[model samples]
Target: MSRKLSWGAAVALVAVTASVTVSLTYVYAMKSFNTKVADINERQAMYTKLSEIDQKTRQDYIGSVNEKELNDGICAGYAAGLGNSQAKYLSAEKYKAYLNGSSEKSIGVGIKTVQDKDGNMEVIEVTPGSPAEKSGIKKGDTIVSMDDKEIVRLTYGDALNKLDGAAGSKVKFGILRRQNAAGPSAEAKAALLSITVTRAEYAEQTLTSSMINGNVAYLKISAFTDSNAEQFNNMLAARIKQGASGIVIDLRSNSGGSIRGMAEMLDTLLPAGNTVSYRDKAGKTTVQYTSGPNTVNLPISVMINRNTFGVAEIFAADIKDYKKGLLVGERTAGLGTKDEVKPLSDGSAIILPVADYLTLNGDVFSGKGIGVDIEKELTSEQQALLVRNQLKGDQDPQLQAAVSALIRQGASVEKAPGTENAPVNSNAAATE
Candidate 1:
């Protein structure tokens, strides 16, 4: 039996309960309000400081300031302050050129270069049949001068800028080439030769495929820019048709590109499943892509290095998650964060991180990059030789490791670890 409360006592209890509930609600509301107020005040203080500085500059600055440059500087500085290396602000003109550059098309003499240890711009790659090649610029040549402008240690970028101009325009260059092409490199004599190259608009070859080690196909993917899926498929199909027992994909310096392109490339091999997902700072995960079911399961080997970034990391991680391939070479660059290119009203743009990429297994390869099953490191000299196209056949240790792994895995590829393949729908993404 329960004891009944008197009406007056019950009324007193109800009043105390209501008072406590109201007090908690008030406290919570105040806490939220105070937080919002603090945030607003902090933002106001920042704006006030900026306004004060702007006023001072306008009043007493001796030099005439270009408003556009000043604004761009501020934007660039703000992005730099974020400490995200990939975050950047691009002016309208640069943004336009950047967009145009993504098609693997260029309006300059086709030669890719890197600043050598000697601080000289050394040619690493010369596009086939390009004006640079036709004009006698080889893979190992160094540009000494461009259009009478000396390409010294400094202002080298300015000198290379001269390579870009109206189509059909000719650019003169002084190239230093080794006289002894096949002799000992340290002792080889070099000569400076002057040549004229025409700047023409042409598509760049993003990938190269060849049959190596008799039954294996080797594909070097330099960058992930333009959608090269069709070409990639054609090359792989040809290799498969030619009895390629294993496939080795070299993404040593492949900074990722189109998410769709990566998906297409991976879809050619990955069975239908959750390939990758995106997780925000709030821990909300949205599936990025579900791979289609039609698959080309093969004894696959993915060769990566410290420079394999963005979607390339995703590609390799996906393969690893599916037990689809052996990742050979160094760990990936681990920069698998997604950035959004937000355009300003003035036609300029800013890129900033929007979220992080998550593998199908809920793995984050952001700052902590993807690891490989076979860890083979490349010496700095050998790495230089690699990007410079100086690595001869059977000389790349990482490639050798990949080839060996593929050969070993070829016989039991289907029996490799991981759950059974499942069918799924569309997905893909990437960066650089």
Candidate 2:
């Protein structure tokens, strides 16, 4: 190695050394890059494993699988895992039925039902002049069976579907009627009865208004539908023209419907201000304000109960917040949120709460319902009796209380002497 070299040999030696240096540098760079790539792949190993499992199941599963069902189940399960009861997934058929039920027109027996503690379908109301009413069905009738199908085994949706059918179709129901009387000695005696009702197309009457105590307007809103605002305005204007000095809005058992309709009604009552605001998860707020002049300056009272939910609760809460009225009856069902129904490509749909609702003053009543100014708590039996009385055209104690409260608040309405809390006979009461 120490021997003297010629000029050509020295040049060749230098070239070889340069080539070796370049190779060594390239190897070191590749090693560093591979370490980073390996770390990244390791960090994402779970995702890759999931993809592999999904692919295997699709191609190599032992049993037959419905891709639609599987995908729907995955979606429903994911929504359920969120742990929100307000969230739900509706099948194509169910979604269609829900939309039809919400519309102003429907084809069915025209009765609303609820599940009792024992899972029996209890008729909450029978629409007047409907087949259910014409067939002698009454409120509080427990449906034991429908067309030989046990109602106890059916879910709420199933029961509703069972009751609904095409126009001119007939359905039979086995009902258990309970004897109702207003006395301490009145015992519930159940009697079995069967009736056949024909389904028919009928217009839904969501609102009814009448003059009470000579100059007070009593409006009962079953639900806040799309046409409720216009109906309410017309009724109010007519009652005002007929010399009504106060208004009592009965929202008991009103499982809420349209929020926009509710806002429209509120705009007529509340002064120009923020009526409600929806707060998203990102802490962003979108508000709805009352525009135009508040024409109805008369005293107002709102009736509510545990069944009053959704937009109805918001209406009551806004009335109380603005000091525009007194809230009577029990506390409301606090379901203060807005649900958005998104339809999927496969005719399925998802309903989820998109935002939490708040009053104009920023009061959130999600779980804790809006408390009543005058709490009138009643037992289930008492409520049943109240409904029975109402069906018989008797004055509802809650409504009478509202009227008395309005009169006490200096409303120009006249209260009959000794008629406080007394039942109003059908012959003497004003027709709605």
Best by TM-score: 1
Residue 379 Cα positional deviation in candidate 1, in Å, after optimal superposition = 1.9
Model 1 regions more than 4 Å off: 1-25, 129-131, 134-136, 146-174, 180-190, 193-200, 412-432
lDDT of 1 by residue, 89-131 (tens): 9989778766766566777898888876666678877777788
Error of 1 at 405 (Å): 1.0
lDDT score, candidate 1, position 6:
75
Which residue pairs in candidate 1 have backbone atoms (N, alpha carbon, C) closer than 3 angstroms, thus clashing?
256-431, 259-428, 259-429, 259-430
Give per-residue CA lDDT, model 2, range 1-432, as digits (tens).
Answer: 444466668888899999899999989989989998998897589568767878999798999989777777767876897798899988777677777766767779988776777887888667777888888998779998888777877666688777776678889998999896779999778899989998987766678777767777878787888777988898888898999889988898887988888889998998878777888888898885554566578999998998899999999998999888899999988899878999988787899999889976787798988898887665566676554434222335567678777877779767652254434222223443
User: How many residue pairs clash in all the candidates, one count each?
Assistant: 4, 0
lDDT of each: 0.79, 0.79
Query: Lowest-lDDT window of 10 residues in candidate 1?
Result: 423-432
